[model samples]
Target: MAAAIGALTLRATRAGLYSRLTSGVQGVDATTYPVLSGLARVGPVTATKLAEAIGMDRTVATRYATRLQEAGLIDRRPDPADARATELVLTAEGERAVTALRGAMESFLAEEMATWPPGEAAAFAMRLEHLTESLVQGEAGRSC
Candidate 1:
């Protein structure tokens, strides 16, 4: 299972599909994709929480957040709960980017599964999501 996942990642990287997918939105690479998606999932979060949610270092999270803010995809606002901390939130543009990214990924997978039976494709997607959720929950702090 691990090998299969790794192989899929390698193939995507080699094919530059990750870059292509991000390019469909705002020229974000694979690395920034996680940050954007993380914000989309749980925005108005401190950099530390965002980092934890995405399995990224706090510093890197801050950097990515900065870039996204500059791109107008994300915005940094004062944390009401913590006067000294800033919360990261996705802007309208960020939401659009996330939506576009999802579309790009779904389109790619849809193309790949076009030849497969509908039931098989659905089952594969469900199982993969379950596996990923389990892995992520079990290894919260570890990058997979």
Candidate 2:
């Protein structure tokens, strides 16, 4: 019962926050933030590698990369290891944007959960993490 209620609340709050944040940032969408942050963390990387890393389809990941490129948040450079492939890198502007976005999201989550005691948040996180892993594993099992 607790897990169910927590899941519902988390989903609703996430939707609300995404709507609010997207409205504030022109030309930025859900995937944009993750892709930019991923690039920032991983340095330059191929779209194929990034797609795998982020668990998105190649086409979907490509679209995100294209959108980021269009917004000047990311740059596509020729891969030195593979002449035919391109590596995605975050621009300075993208770095700034992603850093700000991370801070905002963290702050928002902290505020929303502030009333909850510390152990409650950690327990919620652990359960959610397990749920995510199970779901992914189930998909992988069926695909095989």
Candidate 3:
């Protein structure tokens, strides 16, 4: 019963988070956020490498990159190291969006966690990180 309740709670929290994030973000889908985040983190990288790093198929990753580029959130340039390959970089606007979304998400989470002890929040974060690693490392989109 406790495990069932925990599962339900996790599902509900994820829904609530998407709702809140959607309200906060303008002209962006939650699906695109992670791609933008990757661009921000890794600077410029080839689409193939970015796709591998993000655990998505090359074709799907290319689609996501195209969408992000259409939204002016990312720029694709010819790789200096390999002129035939393209490198993805976050534009200034994408950087702003990333920062804004990060802050909004943090604020939302902090609000939700206000009643919980700091240690509990830390533990929760650690557990989520572990789960994410398991998901990514085991198989793409398996644990999620």
> Which is superior by TM-score, 2 or 3?
2
Instruction: Work out how many backbone clashes candidate 3 has.
Output: 0
lDDT by residue for model 1 (1-144), tens: 778788876866646876778877874676788898888888579999989988899999999888888888988889888799998888888888899998988888889888997699878878989988987788866756
Error of 1 at 74 (Å): 0.5
Worst 10 residues of 3 by lDDT: 18-27
Q: In model 2, which runs have C-alpha deviations exceeding 4 angstroms?
A: 1-16
Which residue pairs clash in candidate 3?
none
The candidate maximizing TM-score is 2
- Superposed by TM-score, candidate 1 places the C-alpha of residue 133 at a distance from the truth, in angstroms, of 4.5
Question: Candidate 1 or 3, higher lDDT?
Answer: 1
TM for every model, in the order presented, reads 0.79, 0.80, 0.76
Candidate 3 ranges beyond 4 A from true positions: 1-16, 140-144
lDDT at residue 77 of model 2 (Cα atoms):
91
Which pairs clash in the backbone of model 1?
none
Q: How well is each residue in 14-36 modelled by candidate 2, as lDDT tens digits?
A: 67766666555655676576677
